[model samples]
Target: MRKTLPLIIFITLTGTMYALGQSAKAIIPLGGNAWVTGKATITDDGLTNWENPQDAISIYFRVDKAAELTFALRVRVPEGKSKISVTIGKHTFSKQVANTGFDTLSIGKVMLQPGYIKVDLKGISRSGNVYADVTDLIVEGVQSANELTYVRTGSSFHFGRRGPSVHLRYNIPQEIKKDVKWFYNEITVPQKMDVIGSYFMADGFSGGYFGMQVNSDTERRVLFSVWSPFNTDDPKSIPDSLRIKLLTKGDKVHGGEFGDEGSGGQSYLLYPWQAGKTYAFLLEAAPDKLYNSTTYTAWFKETGTDKWLLIASFSRPQTFGYLTDLYSFVENFEPDNGDKIRMAYYTNQWLGDSAGKWHAVTGAKYTGDETARKNYRKDYSGGLKDGRLYLRNGGFFDDLTPLNQKLEYRTSLPPPMIDFNQLPR
Candidate 1:
């Protein structure tokens, strides 16, 4: 079932926010949904970083019906008159404003079908220090019999702009339900889909994630991390007994602590992994019920390579269980690159039992985070493609995969043949 956020339309005025249900006019804060190019940026008060006419901004929203939608903008000229334009598809609306104070400027209307819509806002002509500082997009015409989806105000705009993170929850067969000791998966990101800031997570369990990332133009990484048994997000606050103790790391890999999204022991190798090449990830969990602890180790390598370079190993003090809640995911860790679309194909998933037998994964469930569930930035989809489970997000695409949609690859992929004893310690 698609878990959609309630029909809570937000209206921001005088630095305050209020929610209304299917109102005549709903405010879509640019701070939450705008993707800026050039020198333009998003601020707490909205689009205040715009200072150049050459800069461009894109605002995305999804409408669920074919309707004539009216548009308006809340903006400030600061000094003199400025002319700005809002373009949607083939329709463009331009208006002139000279309001020193923030005021609403109507930007005409358009007939739109049911899908994701992009509103391109740019400066046309201005006689001020900067172009219009736009704050919000006020939309009407969808009230009683229509549905609309956009990132709402009064929340963290960073996550809103970074868009939704989707996951593939792999279904481990019931026969291997108890002592699944290892998880193995492969990821192949398509060419041109390797947008910066994308983390194509290949292996994710209840306690940690292992993946490859397009860190920046000059950097790529094979990253791995495991959470501490403590519940705090601050790594420094975790008690030594409950903290994730680093066992070892590979040569040239940086090992340290990470925080803010569940503090954990972090390690990464600065490898220039490229798109279009399949990379392999293997994660192992060894639980000791007597000591109430579990040790997790991660390894990554190219598919054709004979070596599995160990990423890192961590021992969580308060947990004692085999790997459960297995999954893989695709997410944008950096909000600045959220406008660009990225995707990856996860294939040949297998689980290794305690008896050293490999089980082929046949089923998975596609899901999204709070962003997609709340209907904020709906450009996310996932399903089985060519014997592989693929996940996609961003780019403002119209296609949507159903939330919790079950995806299965019926063909039997070749299971991995590994000498477990020869793995790096």
Candidate 2:
């Protein structure tokens, strides 16, 4: 039976940070869920899940840090004379699998870094053109070989089973109230992943969020919208006067990608995007003419480009007037086959006030979906890697967990708080 879970409690914000150390030794798997290059595909034949590639292929994954590693691969050589060669850095090992069933091959230990590492496999010889088949890669023992860093690539907390995704956020130090003008960040869509959800938002009685997304290989867009304090899903339940609008010319508005749980609006299909490219996004919110109303606006510019295109705007009455949260996340939209690895790099985050002053946001806390926190199902992975935030999810991982950690906790300040009690009945 599926279990119901409560929303995660927000961690207190402060200036203190837990000193993270080197990655401890654990068995890390490189399999269908892992990122690969140079010709590989995942296949399941009713029983086993395996990755097969044409001869001379390489697979990549990150480790917490440098360590002496004992590598293992489950192999199936179709013929008696078939042979395979596996190489890691300067080391190489050869083996012959004369049986039809899968067998294990242990490639002895070697030193490796805590970040990304590539393992190469070559089909040396096989009879009648039969290719050698194998499962995933695994490391047996580990010994830290480098100094502790902020993030580790191959950490277990970063990947998992199939389901909803995870999130990472940096709360702004100053409360972006009715007078604040903007929240900004420069981010890159990570190469080789399928989707990323990013946004700058404020938490209040009525919450508002805006950002860009890479939903699929072909679909990329910038989205902006606001959640009404009302709880009804029916758009008609809310007057047209309260709906969000696209103030900019040449932009399209569409139904929000989020499901029906509240009164929310979205403007999307506004622009096209590419992978591995950086784009700057700015979201502005301030009090409107009404005493308790606020106007929300969004702007975007691709890196190396000068124009900051206006995306959309919406005005909410009887609401908090400032931006409260600056956060981003990675998720899989297509549930059936949607669970594939995807990531995005976020940096240069800044918060802007009505006075035209900007403050830098250099650190943040890591969190995940409530379902993932309650269920042991391993379906997502992500966190701060090499000083930038990254998120990964989908595939066949059954032991992956979410990376949930917060840096400095600031008192006298509160993140945008969602008022569930005030939600429309």
Leading candidate by TM-score: 1
Q: Model 1, 238-299: lDDT tens per residue?
A: 98888888889999999999999989899999999988899989999999788899999998
Candidate 1 overall lDDT versus native? 0.86
lDDT agreement with native, every candidate:
0.86, 0.53
Clashes of each: 0, 21
lDDT of 2 by residue, 102-193 (tens): 76767678787655456777666666334556655645454332221111223222323234456667766545444445676666766665
Give lDDT for model 2: 0.53
What TM-score does model 1 achieve against the real structure? 0.93
Error of 1 at 339 (Å): 1.3
Model 1 poorest 10 in a row by lDDT: 11-20
* Cand. 2 TM to true fold: 0.54
